[model samples]
Target: MRKIAFIAFGIALWIFLTPTLEIEVLLTALIASYVAARLVGNVKLRPMKILNFTVLLAYNFLVAVWQSLKIVLGLFDYESKYFEEPAGRDFLEKFEKIVLITLTPFTIVVDEKENVLIIHELKRRKGTE
Candidate 1:
């Protein structure tokens, strides 16, 4: 039910935002989920539950890496790439900003009992694995 509402909202938002919306309905939906989670409470993702997010995160990162590689190659062929002019300096700058923003990890901690959202840094170990 929550997911369905979110999807619908995203479609509406994408329609609202239109073509320039780089992420389209999906990003809108994801953002909606984050917002909803926050509104209700900090959503909890236990270690086991974390696996549920692994795939989507992995896919996003993989696509970002692939696009980054393409962007690199595009830069090399800037003189003849894009069928227009290849992505210009502005495009690269904007893309870098988007990727950097989108990929940064934000941990969502949920107060299950109170239904409140808390965003925090994901802790990392200093020692080697």
Candidate 2:
């Protein structure tokens, strides 16, 4: 099932990318997409999960962009300090932490034993340690 999806995704991607699907292109897309899909098979993500993840990623990206813009504008606005130490939550797995850090500026795994995450922000949210 996953293989089929991967093949389909690969072919679709290839078609969108290339104007003309030559024999070589077809073979290349099939092999590349299959290999890529197999590699990603470890993650075990379904179409709905992938879509949800994409939406979450986009939301986080937009939030990050907004935060970054606010920080940049602060340079001329004189609204607040440049650096801040916002509180962070501990993640169950290091992989999850890594994934989050990839998407957002915050969420760094400080210590594995203590499971501490450090979030960099202009200000810590109220009521959070």
- On TM-score, the leading prediction is 2
Model 2 alpha-carbon drift over 4 Å, by segment: 4-34, 40-43, 75-97, 110-122, 125-129
lDDT of 2 by residue, 36-105 (tens): 7777665444687545654665677677777668658863232222322322353223444444554664
- Which candidate's lDDT is highest? 2
Model 2 lDDT, residue 78, Cα: 27
Inter-residue clash pairs, candidate 2: none
For model 2, the local distance difference test gives 0.57
What TM-score does each of the candidates earn? 0.25, 0.44
Question: What total of clashing residue pairs does each candidate reach?
Answer: 7, 0
- Model 1 residue 65 CA deviation (Å) reads 0.7
**lDDT tens string, model 1, 1-129?**
454444454355445445465655567657775576557453233434234344444566666667568557863222211111122244333333333335544322222222222223333334422
